[model samples]
Target: MELQLALDLVNISEAKEVVAEVAEFIDIVEIGTPVVINEGLHAVKAIKEAFPHLRVLADLKIMDAGGYEVMKASEAGADIITVLGVSDDSTIKGAVAEALKQGKQVMVDMINVKDIEGRAREIDAFGVDYICVHSGYDHQAEGKNSFEELAAIKRVVKNAKTAVAGGIKLETLPEVIQANPDLVIVGGGITGQSDKKAAAAQMQQWVKQA
Candidate 1:
């Protein structure tokens, strides 16, 4: 499993500092939706330019106009762009097509999709790069997680690599790793810790060992 560091609620500079602290431990740096809203695609560009080696994912969580949005994010140097799975199939198709043309990738976020397995099965046919089971902040506040949903999708999704996100932390990481997801996404798990590098390093070590 690969480790993805999610940067949410941070500006361009803070995001840089955080990533620089744990750069060696992370496989991907995520420019989260809030960061995108505050800084625009410039956040993606700045991060990608700063760290050309690490892959950068722009969390657009796009719901429509997938092709145009993907094109814009790809232009800003995003290696992977996200789209909401609840979006129409055509939207996913458009995003996938645009990403392929841009030589980038699309990760479908199943944030609130009611039928995880069913929709994942269908989206797998669209040939997206990743299918992520996610629980939004609100869902997390309600003490919810996507572990079960992750398991649900793993059983059916064949074409896309699987990812799991939503409140994942160092303590709970072993449980996540046991599921053997292709990617493990952590936000506050590392960012909120007293020692970000240690947390990221430990998580990366565990993932690599797993």
Candidate 2:
């Protein structure tokens, strides 16, 4: 399993500082939707420029103009870009095609997709690099999680690597690891900690063991 640190609420400088602290522990540094919205793809560019060794993901959650968006993000140095699972199949395929052309990747985020298993199977067939099971902040506030959803995708997805995200914490990470997701995304779990580096190190150890 690979550990991904989601930098959602931080500014460009803060994101850089936090990643510098835990860079060795993480495989991917996610410039989250909010960060991208706030700082634009400049956030992706800056992070990748600063940490050239680590993979950077731009969480576009793209719902339209898939090919163009993927191309733009890839040009901005994003190693992987995201598209909504609920988007049209053409959109997903467009994103994947662009990503392939750019030598990057597309992660289909199954946040609000109702038929996760069925949709994941379809998206997997579309050649997405990763099919992510995610619960947004709103759903997480209602005590919803992607654990079960992750399992559902794992059971059905054949071609794509599986990822899980949504309020994952140190205590709950083992549970997520039990499901064997290819990527485990953690945001507040590491960012909200008093000692971010130690927290990330511990989480990385757990994921490595898992």
Candidate 2 off by > 4 Å = none
Each prediction's RMSD over C-alphas, in Å, is 0.4, 0.6
The residue pairs found clashing in candidate 2 are none
Model 2 worst lDDT run, 10 consecutive residues: 115-124
- Tens digit of lDDT per residue, candidate 2, span 1-210? 899999999999999999999999999999999999999999999999999999999999999999999999999999999999999999999999999999999999999999888899889899899999998999999999999999999899988999999999989998899999999999999999999999999999989998
Any runs in candidate 1 off by more than 4 Å, and if so which? none
The Cα error of candidate 1 at residue 87, in Å, is: 0.2
lDDT of 1 by residue, 118-196 (tens): 9999999999999999988999999999999999998998889999999999889999999999999999999999999
**What is candidate 1's CA lDDT for residue 91?**
99
TM-score of 1: 0.99
Best model number under lDDT: 1
